[model samples]
Target: MNSAKSPAKKSWLQTLIKNKNERKKVIFIFTISFLLVVAGLIYIPIYKHSLPLDSKIYEGNFKELGSIARIGFFAALAIYPIFLLLKWKPLSHIKKGNFELKPLIQFLAKYVRQWHVPIALISTAMIILHGYMALIKGFQANFTYFSGIITMAVLACLLVMGVKRYKRTDKKWHLKFAISFLVLFMIHATFS
Candidate 1:
């Protein structure tokens, strides 16, 4: 029999996938990620080498795409603090029996909350595109690619963790993951 005194079965990975919706999210994310990586690892090289040397992204809109991806990366990063603020309600003034800006805070929170998922998805897509392009061209052995891979993978996990309510106390884990990703992303950017 399930006893009341039994401690809840908590999983480190369970925090990342909290609910059915989140499970769906992770599944979709994994699918997309796998396809992109596989294409980069396999299809990209084949397609590139099979084509004429003149037919290349570097010669055309690849730079523009990369720029868009860069912008998306920063945009997603910007959301981290905003998200923390919203979720944590860290403004002490707002909590100390303050009613002057409750509605305003709620309004801002609503907007920021809506943005979290879309921002994560868009940024993930952009990073994948950037990586795919780089890989297609020629994925060399360098810290840049390695760091980027780690960053992107961590970012995906972070997004998945934030997607749904799996555990009540997952915020700390999310925070940790976010910080780790930010650090890794910085390393990737620096090496880039």
Candidate 2:
């Protein structure tokens, strides 16, 4: 009978309450990512249908590629935050023989933590393709265009830093650059 109530089959909320902070952070990031994508989906058709053809700002000239890139970008944004959750304090407490968690949580965390690098590499490819279509195809240098360039440059620096995994490198720069890129991305997306 105890097997039926095992943690493995518990609702996500139950598992989450046990691993509170990390789960909360993951939920928050997922919520934001979902909202951003949904907002884009809602806004795109309305923008196209409601506005004049001349000012249809985001017909996204490259259509399908643009759509795929936008989705990939939001997905990457969502995945990046989950990295923090992988650093479990419980792991250190294991030596004390006092650790307890659902097997499902353990499995999920391990899978997510292991995939961070791969997710980043995939996101990079999608962003590169998106950038190429947006900036290189016609090569327009404006506020919208330059903001994207700056964001992309910083994002590339971040990827290099992640790959290097330098013990001595100050991590604040990573946080700072990420915030900077986010602001730049907002501006770029808004004006583009």
Candidate 3:
């Protein structure tokens, strides 16, 4: 029953998900997400009071936790460097026509696989803490909290999917979830 001109059954999204270049694009998307989160935190005043005499981040014991969260944010942002190094070695290997990726890629991939769960958990916690700080400051506006909340949720889902994929030993689905999460996070960051 097959015809020479039989049409492709897969949708465009399927095609996109299967694209080879999507791997590196996914990494860059996360890099941009990291930058956006960092930038937003920098420019936005974290604590706003809905009521008089409320605790401000600068003037209270909250400062310590805030500092810790800030440190975590910076660390999370810094992790992108590992991604860059991973990409560099593989890209160079590929460019030289070596079908075999550098051994470093395996090392990097192992770290990327093993670390994602804990990283996502800590990152989710930090985002919550940051949101709490934001709340103490009265930033309940639709755009701020809603977008931030959505972004965190998307990231959490992505992390869970990623971890599941890793356990199932499926690289394709892992990258798909990761890329979708990155895209959602970026949109969320932009709105926030």
Clashes of each: 1, 0, 2
Best by lDDT: 1
For model 2 the local lDDT of residue 120 reads 51
Candidate 3 overall Cα lDDT vs. reference? 0.55
- lDDT for each of the candidates? 0.63, 0.57, 0.55
C-alpha RMSD by candidate, in order: 6.8, 13.9, 13.5
* Candidate 1: residue 182 lDDT (0-100): 70
Q: Residues 19-86, candidate 1, lDDT per residue (tens digit)?
A: 55655665676677567556655754676666553555453544455566566656655655655565
Of candidate 1, the 10-residue stretch with the lowest lDDT total is: 53-62
Overall local distance difference test of candidate 2: 0.57
Residue-wise C-alpha lDDT for candidate 3, range 62-99, written one tens digit per residue: 34544454444444444455666666744554644546
Writing each residue's lDDT as its tens digit, candidate 2 over 1-192 gives: 465654567675654344556446545655654565456455545664554434334335444454565555555554445555446566544432554444445676666654454455555555565565454345676886787788889888776565443343645665566567667766777677
From the highest TM-score down, the ranking of the candidates is 1, 2, 3
Best by TM-score: 1
